[model samples]
Target chain A: EAEVAQSPRYKITEKSQAVAFWCDPISGHATLYWYRQILGQGPELLVQFQDESVVDDSQLPKDRFSAERLKGVDSTLKIQPAELGDSAMYLCASRIVAQSNEQFFGPGTRLTVL
Target chain B: SQQGEEDPQALSIQEGENATMNCSYKTSINNLQWYRQNSGRGLVHLILIRSNEREKHSGRLRVTLDTSKKSSSLLITASRAADTASYFCATDPRGGSYIPTFGRGTSLIVHP
Candidate 1:
C-alpha cells in the first residue's frame, strides 16, 4: 500500500526560529491536507490543496504559517519565528479523487519549540 | 471549528474486553470516520460510516452512525494491548468542501 511521506519526524528548535516540514503524498492523489494537533486534542486543518491551488486555509495563522504544494505532488509547510504555542504534531494527509472519504496519513513531523 | 465531540475522555480495559467510544456532532455530515493514533505517531484510518448507513464492521472494529441524532459509536471487540491508543472521530460535513473536522479523542488503554 502506498503511503504519504513526511520528513524530519522530530524537530526541536528555539522560539523565534524558522522551521519547515515536508510531505509527499501518495502518487495520483490530488487532494493534500496539512493539520496541526495539540497534545490530547484531535488534529485541526491548517490548509488544503487541490492539485497546485489552495482550496481552504481559513484556520491557518497566515501571519506566521504558510504552506505550498508547488507541483501538486509534494508540499512544504513553513513557520517563521516559531512560538512556544506552535509546538505540536504537524500531520500531512492525502485523499484520492473519486474515492471514499478515507484519507491516508503520514507519520507526522513533531515540532517542539523551546 | 470542531463539529464532533467524543464522550469519555479516557477509558481503561483489560485484555479481551470490548471497548466502546461515542461521538456526537453538531451538524449534518456526509460521513463520519474513526481513526487511531498511538503514542508519538500519526493517525491511522480505522473505519468510516456514511450518513445513509447505520452500521459498518471491519475486522474487530464496529462503527454505527445515527444521522438523526448526529452521533456515532466505535466498538472494538476483544481488544488487546495493541489497541491502546487515542481514538478520534472525524466528520466530513455535507457541504461543497471535503474538509474534515476532528474532535478531542478518547484515550483508551487496554491493559495486557
Candidate 2:
C-alpha cells in the first residue's frame, strides 16, 4: 500500500520564528490537502491543490501561512512569525482521481511554538 | 461553518463492549466518511457510506446512514483497548466542489 509521507514528525520553535513542513503524497494522486488540527478539535482545511493549481484557500490565513505544491506531487506549508496559538498538528492528505471521497493521510507534523 | 457534528463528545467503555457514536450534518451530502485518529497523529479513513446506501459493514465496524434525517451512526463491536481513539465524521456536499467538511469528533476510550 502506497502511503503519503511527511517529514519532521515533531517540530518545536519560538513564537516569532518561521517553520516549514513537507509532505509527499501517494504517486498518481492529483489532489492534495493541508489541514491544521487544534487539540480537542477537528481538522480545518488550510489549502487544497489540484495538479499544482490551488483549488481552495479561503480558510488559509494568508497573512502568515502559505502552502505550495509546485510539482503537484509533493507540497510544503510554511508559517512565518509563528504564534503560540499556531501550535497544532499539520496534516497532509491526498486523493486519487478515481476515489471520490476517500483520502490518504500522512503521519502529520506536530508543531509546537513556544 | 462545520457540516457535521458528532454526539456524546466522549465515551468510555470496557473491552468486549460495543460502542456507538452518532453524527449529524447540515446539508445534502453525496457521501459520508468516518475517520479515526490516535493522539498526536494523522487521521485514518475507516469507512464510507454513500447517500443512497443505508448500512455498510467491515470487520468489527458498522456504519449506517439516514439521508432523510441527515444523520449517521458508527458502531464498533467487541471493542478492544486498541480501539481507543478520536473518531470523526466527514461529509462531502452534493455539489461538484468535492471538499469534505469534518466534525469535532467523538473521543472513545476502551479500557482493558
Candidate 3:
C-alpha cells in the first residue's frame, strides 16, 4: 500500500537553531496536515492544507512556525530559532479530498532540541 | 486539556483475552474515532463511529458509542501479542470541519 513519506526520521539540534521537516503524502491525496506530539500525548494539529490552500491553522504559532505546500503534493514545516519545548514528534497525515474521511499518517520526524 | 479522556491509563492482558477501553468526552461530537500507536511512532486509524451509529465492528474490534452520555468504548477480542499498543479516542465536535481532538490514550500491553 502507498504510504505517506517523511524524511529525517530523527533530528537533533541545539536551542535557538532552525529546523525543517519534509513530508510527501500518498499520491492523489488532496488534503495534508501537520501535527505535533509531545511525550505521552496525542498528536496536536498545527496546520492543515486543502490542495494548495491552507484550510485551518489556528493552533500554529505564526511567530516561529510556518508550513507550506507549494505544489499541493508535498509539504515542508520549518521552525525558526527552535526552543527546548519544540522538541517533539512532528507527524504528517493526508487524505483524499473527494472522499474526505479516514486519514493515513507517516512515521513522523522526531525532533530533539537540546 | 483534551476533550476526550480514555479510561485505564494502562492495561495488561494475556493473549486470547479481550481488551476493553472506554473513552468519555466533554462536549457534543460529530463522530468518535479510535487510533492505535506502537511505541513512539505515528498513529494508525482503526475505526470511526459516527454520532448516529450506536455500534460498529471490524474483525475482532468492536466499538460502542453512547452519545447521550458522551462516552465510547473499544473492545478488542481474542487479541494477540502484536495487539499491544497505545489506543486513543478522538472526537470531532459538532459544527466543525477541522481535525479531531484526541485524549492521552490507554497504553495496552498484551502479553503472549
Cα-based RMSD of the predictions, in order?
A: 1.1, 1.1, 1.5
Give me the displacement of residue A90 in model 1, in angstroms: 0.3
Better structure of 1 and 3 per TM-score: 1
State the interface C-alpha RMSD of candidate 2: 1.8
CA lDDT, candidate 3, residue B81: 99
Worst 10 residues of 1 chain A by lDDT: A95-104
Looking at model 3, the pairs that clash are none
Give residue B99's lDDT in candidate 3 (0 to 100): 63
Question: lDDT by residue for model 3 over A8-110, one digit each (tens)?
Answer: 8999999999999999999999999899999888888899899999988899998999999999999999999899999999999898972246778999999
Candidate 2 TM-score restricted to chain A: 0.96
Q: Which CAPRI category fits model 1?
A: medium
Taking candidate 1, what TM-score does its chain B reach relative to the real chain B?
0.97
DockQ of each: 0.72, 0.67, 0.60
Candidate 2 off by > 4 Å: none
| lDDT (10s digit) by residue, model 3, range B1-112 | 5889999889999999999999999888878889999998989999999989999999999999999999999999999999999999988778766566789999999999
* lDDT (Cα, tens digit) per residue for candidate 1, span B1-112: 7888998899999999999999999988888999999998999999988888999999999999999889999999999999999999999888767678999999999999
**Model no. 2, DockQ:** 0.67
In candidate 2, what are the lDDT values of residues A1-114, reduced to their tens digit? 899999889999999999999999999999999999999999998998998999889999999999999987899999998999999999999998523869999999999999
Off by over 4 Å in 3: none
Model 1 is docked with a DockQ of: 0.72
Candidate order, DockQ descending: 1, 2, 3
How far off is residue B3 in model 3, in Å? 1.8
- For model 3 the local lDDT of residue A33 reads 89
